[model samples]
Target: MKKFYYTLLALFFMLPACTKTDIVPFTPETDNQLLEYKIVNVQGSPIYGAINQQDSSITVYLPFYLQLITLEPEMKVSDGATVTPVSGTMIEDLLDLFHKGREIKYNVKGKDGKVKTYTLHVQVQQPDLILQEVSTDADNPNTYSLNMNLDFDSFSFGLDGAGFAADLDMIRVMLVDEQNKEYGPLNISTFNTTDLTRLDFTVIRYKEQSDPILAMLPAEGLYRIRVYSYAKVATTKNPIRINLLNKK
Candidate 1:
């Protein structure tokens, strides 16, 4: 009985040491913080609603020649959290108007007292080229012909695009043969300057003996006319191509 009583006393003394210590639980954020960002107003035909959000950053591609660089954005953030540079806020113009993009920071404070900063990138994109019309000197309505043996004249076309022509650093015109040979930064003239939405340009073939435009191409083969757009800041997208054939 004495030994049993001593064993009970030892067990009681060890109970406190066996107790588990209290610890704080770990938490991972899974809330949908940003819902949407929409462009509200703009001038003359600038593209909008191009907001792409990844994680905590948002990107907006604006037209290159957009004169009024200001914009009002509508944003939707998580519930119980407030954001700065609030929705419908008219952001000021870009710092380096013609050469650089703008950045806006949005601060969000959640209900848990945590603050996060999201970056908004406003960038410009290179204009896209489109062939609105093409014409050749071929008399036959059914077939087109190119007589490189002649003075290399009588070809013209109209060009337009999804962006402004003023945004382009330069437009390169090339003729690609089936064998992948490219020829001519063909001289072209524009009809107007201010409104570049639609440009009517006429292709002028050089008559120089040493020029590639004077070289005699295949009499009967497939050829392509490519127009490339180079922007001042943005990456140039794919060039526009127009296919033609000479059935000589």
Candidate 2:
């Protein structure tokens, strides 16, 4: 009788570890619960192209162009469950910010009154450059155009600031048009005298698909303007600039 009891106990313990699906959990009573979640040790941005799935908490690198995302499995939710305010983030910072060597905790609770909140943390560091697209002519005060030029800062060219400027590899630019279509597949590798980051998106303004500057739209809409590799941060002072010229 004693041997049988021991075997049954071991099976009970193993069953949960084997059968339970590993995923973020969800609840019905609180939107604030999910909002409190956070990440650590990631160097990217708030509009991250997608998400990183690991055994631990998701990593969110600030100012990079990445965002945190989570999907929970439902056992009790019927007819499909939904989470409101699905994603949240912190003040955009430009650096490798570790979560103070601690995990961030959220207060997630389900309709059944079960709490699923968790904690996260990350390591931080300073980035090399700033990624931005401020108007070259501030007086214009217009959103970027499909046909535009990057207006970089004064330090932008030559062997003085950094060696990489002379041997730069790529300049990637992308934009989605008003018709829910991506107008570019544009990529630039040439630097005029100033190494002023330039991406020719003039063809895209007419809603045409161009390569090296890839874009895809849902319909017809100018929903996004993206520039990368100019720096690590989503918003920066130099490295790149967007001069929305007069509808070229």
Whole-model lDDT values for every prediction: 0.55, 0.34
- For residues 1-248, what per-residue lDDT tens digits would candidate 1 score against the true structure? 99999999999999988968799898855343666776767755534443334557777777555434467888877788777878788876453433334457888777887777788766566454455333233232123343444555444555554454563335455556656566766554654666666544443344554334434444444445555543332221222233223314
Worst 10 residues of 1 by lDDT: 234-243
Tens digits of per-residue lDDT for model 2, 18-68? 766689777544322333233333543222221222222434333423322
In the order shown, the candidates' Cα RMSDs to the true structure are 12.4, 18.9
> For every model shown, what is its TM-score relative to the native structure?
0.37, 0.25
Runs of candidate 2 exceeding 4 Å displacement = 1-117, 128-135, 140-173, 176-209, 212-225, 228-232, 235-248
* lDDT of residue 73 for candidate 1: 82
Q: Please give the lDDT score for candidate 2.
A: 0.34
In TM-score terms, candidate 1 sits at 0.37
The segments of candidate 1 whose C-alpha lies over 4 angstroms from its true place after superposition are 1-32, 42-55, 63-68, 95-102, 128-248
Worst 10 residues of 2 by lDDT: 153-162
Predicted candidate 2: what Cα RMSD to the true structure? 18.9
